[model samples]
Target: MKHIRNFCIIAHIDHGKSTLADRLLEHTKTIGERDMMNQVLDDMDLEREKGITIKSHAIQINYPYKGEEYTLNLIDTPGHVDFSYEVSRALAACEGALLLVDASQGIQAQTISNLYLALDNDLEIIPVINKIDMDGAMIPEVTDQIIDLIGCKQEDILLASGKSGIGIEAILAAIVERIPAPKGDENGQLQALIFDSVFNSFRGIIIYYRILNGSIKKGDKIQFASTGQEYFADEIGVLKLTMTPKPEVKCGDVGYLITGIKVAKEVKVGDTITLANNPAPMIKGFEEVKPMVFAGIFPVNTDDFAELRDCMEKLQLNDASLTFELETSQALGFGFRCGFLGLLHMEIIQERLEREFNQTVITTVPNVSFIAYTSKGDKIIVNNPAEMPDPTKLDRIEEPFIKAQIITLPDYIGNIMTLCLGKRGILINQSYLTTTRVELTFEMPLTEIVFDFYDKLKSQTRGYASFDYSPIGYREADIIKMDILLNGDKVDALSALIHRSRAQDFGRKLCEKLKELVPRQQFQIVIQAAIGAKILARENISAMRKDVTAKCYGGDISRKRKLLEKQKEGKKRMRQIGNVEVPQEAFLAVLKLD
Candidate 1:
């Protein structure tokens, strides 16, 4: 136990965290040269395609230093804000963290956020500068930034290039020397902290845990402190690239336990595991993750509802942050109101459903929860636009707010401020990190930036700015629910929440966009945007005209007029009686408007 070192790698996205992990595996000879691959820890296909880490992975390596063998356990964590909960859990299971910063990019938004998380956990941080081989590398400037940020000596910051394997031996030596070994009571009652879990079709729920107080072995009966569920441990093992079975897992060791539980929901992350016979006190667990965005997910085919539900259940077992409930829409039919951490999380879930389960799905517009006070002295929280109460029945409406932090070059300050103000953002504070870069803070409505804010920011700054935000308390706002009407009938799927001041402009843009997306029909289609009984904007798509005059070769002018009048009357009746079928693309077109 004295020779065991447990640590994790933390960094912003695309900062060479995974590459560093690969190099460490090579330096320790845990994985052979032929088996070496880029981002071997990132196992998900979507993660590889998007070039981001979506899941946290843990591995054990054996390193020998000066005739003394040391056991090193490294946990690779996701850098995106959506997976911050996973990062926190990984941090809780470790004694130290390797903070990787890009030598050229310096510190980014996520880098600052993750560094604060490590600090909160009270873990020893080993600052390492990566990508030194790049031509644009600014090692000296980044070293000074690290010194100012963490108050560490300039020499303490290790320089390495993950791609070229530079300083690989030095990083491993630092981990063995600087990171403290895990301390636990081997003779105490059995207690362990489950940091992650995965469901296997053959083995049931495989729990990844860190032993804190005692030991666990095959045939030992274990109990969960949170759920009070007991199960017999069928197998115990450590992961060496893959699970390798062992007879026992001692205190301060990281490994997995096969609980023989078939259901995924039976096991949970952040739960304490202890012996059923003589259980010890439970360890402190992290707070539950709250979702930031909510949307409705319905199957394109109504018969696939059961399959969709089953797929979601399996996914929820691996992802604790995902939340969903049964919901029905008159326009969309039966589906789930799903809650996600952010847009990326939502997109990944949808993609998995389609690719893994072969079930096509339709997702409604994403929205934030709003608190509505009713005239009858009742408070209601709504996440879907259709669930909103009638305009007259509400006393007041409060929308979720977020505190946004944007870091960028000083030259782009004017463009960023203009974009922020256009989204109804209130400038709270501003500061300078250096003479060339600025940090701007704003308090804005969550709904304003939930969709196009990041894209627009990237476009304005030419991809130089980094942004991060967190939810604050709700604030009162002059918000109104706007509806889209096709052929004089309101479509529930196209309703949106907008401020009164921008309602006219928003409605006009939506109407114009919808007109282009909706297919032409035999009769004229009238697209209208309305707020309650008042119509804000309307667009007319004329009917496909057939030449009534073409048929009359040499008719009198009066006869032609009569024929045209009859044709006009016939078209009017058809418009009133005909039903307009709005396609799926029309409903989703409103999301793409600027």
Candidate 2:
């Protein structure tokens, strides 16, 4: 165990984390040149295409230090705030973390937040300033920032360029020398923490766990402590680029287990696994994930509902942060109310369902969960606007609030403050990190930032501002349920709960967007955004007329007028009878109402 060093690399998005991991893997000779590629740990096509790491990956490598063979387990984690849960799970299985910060960008919001997470887990921190090869790299300034943030000495900060492969040897040496070896009793009771898991159709569920005590081998009877289900360990292995099967894995080692359990819902990430015959006490696992955004996910075809559920189960296994429950909408029929960490997380999950699982789905308008108190003193959790109680019956609504932190340059601070203030942000604190760098804090509603605030912040600050937020609690708000109606009928899937102050502008923009996207029919479609019985905004999509006057040519004016009148009557009848289904794009267009 003294030779085993388990650690993870964490940073803000686009801080060269994956790039650094590639260099480390190359220097350690864990992966061969033929099998190597950029962002090798980010194997998913979506991740590669987006130039981001959406999932946390684990790999084992051997590093020779002082002529002694040392085993190192490296977990490469996603840097986005939406995927912070991934970092948390990876941290739980490690004894140390590589706190990678960008030299050009200095320490950003996620860099600090992920640092706190590592500190909370009692993991040793190795601060490495990456991307020092960049032209704009500020090595000295970033070093001071790191020192001030972590209270570490000047020499403790390592300077490395992931792009040019500089300081790779020093980083490896630091991993071996600074990071402590995992401690566990190989002869103690069997106790392991299941940090992550994935589903394989042919092999059942494959789980990645770090053994805290004792050992496990093939054919051992293992039980999930939470579920109390026992299964035979069909395969035990250590993780390589591809899994390498082994006879057994000992304490303080991170490895994978294949139990041949076909059901995806049966296995839970963060669940403790122990020998069923000689069970160990449950290990403290992760806290339940509180999702920041909620939306509806329905199959394009109702018959595929069961298959989508199965796909969601497998997805939830891989992503423990995603939460879902069966929900039925008046307009969309059967679907699941899915909770996600943020909009990006929701988008990735929706895309993964389509690409990976071959499930075609329709995503509705995303909204934050709300707590509604009724006149009868009953509290209701409203995840869907369609679930909101009647106006007369509801006493008040409480919405989630978050304390947001933004670190940016002095030049963009004014624009950022204006943008955030427009979102109803309240100024809490402001300070300067250096002569040119500033950090601003605000208390704002979580719903305000759920949609376009991030995009606006990036655009306003020219992508220089880094933002991070944590939910504070619920606060009373004058929120109303806004319903969209097409041709006088409500579309429940297009309903949303919004603040009363911004409801009119939001409704107007939504109606305009829908008008631009909805197809024209034989009759005019009246699109209305309404709150309760009052219509807040409206738009009309003109009918695709046949031009009855074109055929009337040179006839008497009365005759032409008579023809037009009859046509108008027919159109009015058609409008009364014609039923409209809200376009799928219209639902998603609400996300871009910038």
- The lDDT per prediction is 0.88, 0.92
How does candidate 2 fare on TM-score?
Answer: 0.97
Could you tell me the lDDT of residue 436 within candidate 2?
A: 77
Query: Candidate 2 on 1-594: residue-level lDDT in tens?
Result: 899999999999999999999999998889999999999998889999999999899999899999999999999999999999999999999999999999988889999999999999999999999989889999999999999999999998899998889999999999999999988889999999999998888888899999999999899999999999999999999999999999999999999999889888788888899999999989985887889999899998888899899999999999999999999988778999999999899999999998999998989888899999999999999988878999999899999999999999999988988998999999999999888789999999988988889988999999999999999999999999898899989988888899999999999998999999988999999999999899999999999888888877786799889989999999999988888767778778888787
TM-score of each: 0.95, 0.97
Model 1 / residue 263 / CA error / Å? 2.5
Quote the lDDT for 448 in model 2: 92
Local error of candidate 2 at residue 525 (angstroms): 1.9
The lDDT leader among the candidates is: 2
Candidate 2, position 350, lDDT: 90
- The global Cα lDDT (0 to 1) of model 2 is 0.92
Q: Per-residue lDDT for 1-594 in model 1, tens only?
A: 989999999998889999999989988889988888889898888878888888899999999998999999999999888788789989999999999999999888888898999999889999999999999999988888789889999879999999999999999889988988888899999889999887778888788999999899899999999889989899999988989999999999999999778776677788899999997777985778888888889888798888888788878877778899999987778999999988878888888778767878888878788998899979999888787898788999999999999989998999999999999999999998867668899999988887778889999999989988888999999988899898888887788887788899989999999888888877899999999999999998889878887777785898889888988898889989987876778756766779
